[model samples]
Structure formats: C-alpha cells, structure tokens
Target: MLSIPTFPETDHQIVRSLASYSDRELVSLHQLHPEQGKFFAALFCRYGAIVHSVVQHAVESQLQADYLFAIAWRQIFGELHRVKLAADPEATNWQNWLIDITGNTIAQIEVPPSAQIRYTLNTAPPPLWCYLERGLDLLPPLSRLIVVMTQSLKWKDRRISAYLQGEGQQIPPDSIPNYLIAGYQQLEAAVPQDIREIYQSGIGKQADALN
Candidate 1:
C-alpha cells in the first residue's frame, strides 16, 4: 500500500492542501465544479489502506475482498460530495468520518455460502429463523410489508407507521414483530429442510451487510 503521510505536517502536498480546506470549502468545490478527480485522488491516498483493511475483514477471501473494495470505491465516487459537505469534515476528527464510511462499507458485504451465521438447532434441520425469512414471500400482504420495512429496510417505526397509515391500516410498533412471527410460523410449516438453511443464511448475511 502507498503511504501518504497524515495531514498538517505530511510530505503529501495534497494532504496539506486539504487540511486547510474546510468541509464547506471541499463541499462547495465539489458542488460548484465539474468533477472531483484530484480531490478524490488525495482522499484515496490518505485512506485507501484503511478502506482495504475494512473490506478484507468482512470478506476474508482475497478475490471477494477485492470485489468489495471496488464496490466501496464506486460508492465513494458516487457519494463523495455528500461526505465532504457533511456537518464536520474540517474538524480534527475528520478521519472518524472516513472510518465510519469504511466500516459501513464492510458491514454491507455478503458472507459466502459456506457461512451460516446464526445458531443451528439440530443436525437434522436448521434453525427456525432460516425458514422464517424464506416464508417472507408467502406472508400476508400487510404483514410482509411490516416485516420487510422494519427488518430488511431498517426503517424507523414512525416512518413505518406513516406508511401503514397511508395503506389504510394502522399498526403500532409493538405489533410489528407479531406480524412477522405469524408469517414465519406459517412459512416454517411449508418449507423444505434444505431450503430453510439457505434462507436463514441469506437473511443473516443480508442483515450483516447492513451493519
């Protein structure tokens, strides 16, 4: 990995240049300009290793890690403007923001097929949660809606409530799990043992991807 010295006293002039540029300055520059080729290059030099470490930790496989790193790089390009303009980019704690970005990127990785992240119940069959997620497709319309919004999308209860209200049925936050649970139970009755394993593993990794 290339070493670009940390800002303030770093031999990297781009680092020094950005160190003096406020978050607003960087944001405005990005917003008011045609592109951020040079600006992003400086940031990549400054934190590329940190980002690589993050992706490597999640994927463990070199090939997959490289793929995930490429995905993160693309995200940085797409979202760079938002990050630079974020509330406190100029502060000394700027690296924290970068770390947060990298960490979020890591969480979004899909664990491979061999990994079943949740606890298994028995050798004869997989855990209950495995069947539950698979059953998601068969659930009652409103129940499936609640579970997907609350669990998969991770939306706040208030937003979910509003959405439900728009659908002409109101449900409290406390009842969300019940709806999901009932849906899962029905799904369990119908799923094959092997199918349950795959469903459970996929959802767990999907949730991890959100971490």
Candidate 2:
C-alpha cells in the first residue's frame, strides 16, 4: 500500500525553484517521488492564483472563499497523484483538471449557514472586494488611504481630514469627497475589463436578489 505524501511544512527557495518545470513534468516528478513535496509545492505556487480566482468567483465573500479555498487545496493534494494528463490537446492541461477537482470539492463540502456569506441590500460581493483591492494598489497613497477610511472604516470627511492634518498633511475636509471620487475613477480605469465584468456581474446578481 502506498503511503500518503507529506506536504511542504513551509515554502522555501528550493521548492519554489521547481516552478520552472512544466505542468506535466511536475506531475511526473511528484508521482515518481511522492515524498518530495517540492514538486507539489511548485504546482501550488504556479496555479494558486487561478485556483483562488475560481474559488472567489464561486463564493459570496472573501471569508467564505478563503475557507473553501484551503479545503479545496487539501482535497486536490490528496487526489493529485491519481490525476493523469489526457491525450486530447485541450483536455490535457493540468489547469483544466485542477479546476474540475476544485469545483467538485466545493460542491461536496457542506458549509454551515453561519459560515456562508449573507449578502444584504447594501453589501458588495467577493468580486468587487477583489477588484477594489487590486484597484487600491494602483492609486496614489493618500487617495488609497482616503478611500479606505471613507468607505471601509465609515469615517466622515471631517474625521479623515483631521486625521491627515494630525499626520502633517493639510488636507481640508472639503476636498475629501473629491479625493474619494477621483480615487474611484482611477480604480475604474486601472482595473482590467475582465475583472470589471466580474464585478458588474456580482452587482447584477445582488440587484436581482434584492429586487
């Protein structure tokens, strides 16, 4: 009987170096040396973003997505050894296989109602949260801080201005709203079209549910 392979205890440079291997090559190495976690670690590092994207799209909120994402990876790690590359060119990709596994794992997991994200009339879904996070990175530092304080922390314009004033920046409270508008406009432009579509789709779903 084959023993289960151990996962990497921590990410290291040596494991990360295996990222250069092709998907098929990595799978072969993992199958050949199941105990060597570097190969699987390489697979995770290569495809983690896409996996998280898939999970985020399926779940209602970041917290739910994160929970399911970790569970999905655990399931993937367990079954990855049995995966084989198909002969069909389109079907042979590791990404396609991984996505299938992730979807199946998500479908099977029974999350408690309290753990699920409960959307309301005012709440934004995971897509917007993701888009806003990426968009915030592209903004000027002050604008990002202003937007976060205004929207996320629910700070009033005067409070934000006062805070900035204490920090030695003489931003008047009257300019706070303009800064928020400009920051939002920059986020709209800086976020890619595809991500924007996902954000819009999330909004549409919420609207339909609310109505």
Q: Score each candidate by Cα lDDT.
A: 0.51, 0.62
Can you write out model 2's per-residue Cα lDDT over 1-211, one digit (the tens) per residue?
A: 2112223322456555665677888887878875355566567656766777777666665556655665677677667778888655455678877999989977898644534334331243233333345456778999778877875566899999999999998989999898878877776665555435433443223322111
Please give, for residues 5-36, the per-residue lDDT of candidate 1 as tens digits.
22221234434567666545554565565222
TM for every model, in the order presented, reads: 0.37, 0.46
**Candidate 2 residue pairs in backbone clash:** none
Candidate 2: stretches off by over 4 Å: 1-11, 86-91, 113-211
At residue 44, candidate 1 shows an lDDT of 53
Q: Please tell me which predicted candidate would have the highest TM-score against the true structure.
A: 2
Model 1 C-alpha RMSD to native: 16.9
